[model samples]
Target: MGFLTDTTHMHIFTWVVGIVLFLVAASMANGTKGKKITHMILRLFYVLIIITGAALFFKHMTIDSMLYGIKFVLGILTIGFMEMVLVRGNKGKNTGLMWILFIIALLATMFIGFKLPMGFNFFA
Candidate 1:
């Protein structure tokens, strides 16, 4: 139970995995054949990300909920666009727009995440 609330470790681990999976999914999207198993596993990783993210959100909420809220929304969007890119890529459809959206969402999410209180100190 305690692990569920303080999920920084789990969150970071899953976040790294999710990024790696995203790259795999993106590459597969460019192929003629589809990777059902990869997509399925990626979906599972996404759920883990969301669960840990929600836990982190509530655990670190502050007076200015706006920043956290923005991060929350962007995080969800990042997953969404990632999924979209996979789907479109499998269908051999144009995924340029989804790629752009996913990258923007990802960058924004990471920036906000690192800017949080006692968050990742890139300079450190």
Candidate 2:
């Protein structure tokens, strides 16, 4: 439990890997085996991100609960947009709107996350 107690580093690592994987997969041709494999690996990273993020969220739940709650929701939306963009793109459907929403949600989530008491105080 000690390793999981402070998950900020783990959470950041997961998201970084996830983003890289997303870009790799997105660049590949749709319906290809390599793309599918990369996507599956990316999905695993997504789960890791969520689990680590939840741990951090619960650990800091007492400090500015409202802001943490908002961060949590926005975090979920960010993940959702990431998945939507990939899936829709892979299906050969237009994902322009999803990409815009994904960027917005990701930026908002990161901004709030860094401003939180548990975060690195980059905003302060």
Whole-model lDDT values for every prediction: 0.84, 0.86
What are the per-model C-alpha RMSD values against the true structure? Answer: 2.2, 1.3
lDDT of 2 by residue, 1-124 (tens): 4465454777888888988998898889988999999999999998988888888877778854688889889989988998898899988899999999999998999999888876787866
Deviation in Å, model 2, residue 60 alpha carbon? 1.2
Q: Which pairs of residues have clashing backbones in candidate 2?
A: none
| 29-82: candidate 1 lDDT, tens digit per residue | 354345677778889999999998898888788876678888989999999999
Give every collision pair in model 1.
none
Scored by Cα lDDT, where does model 1 land? 0.84
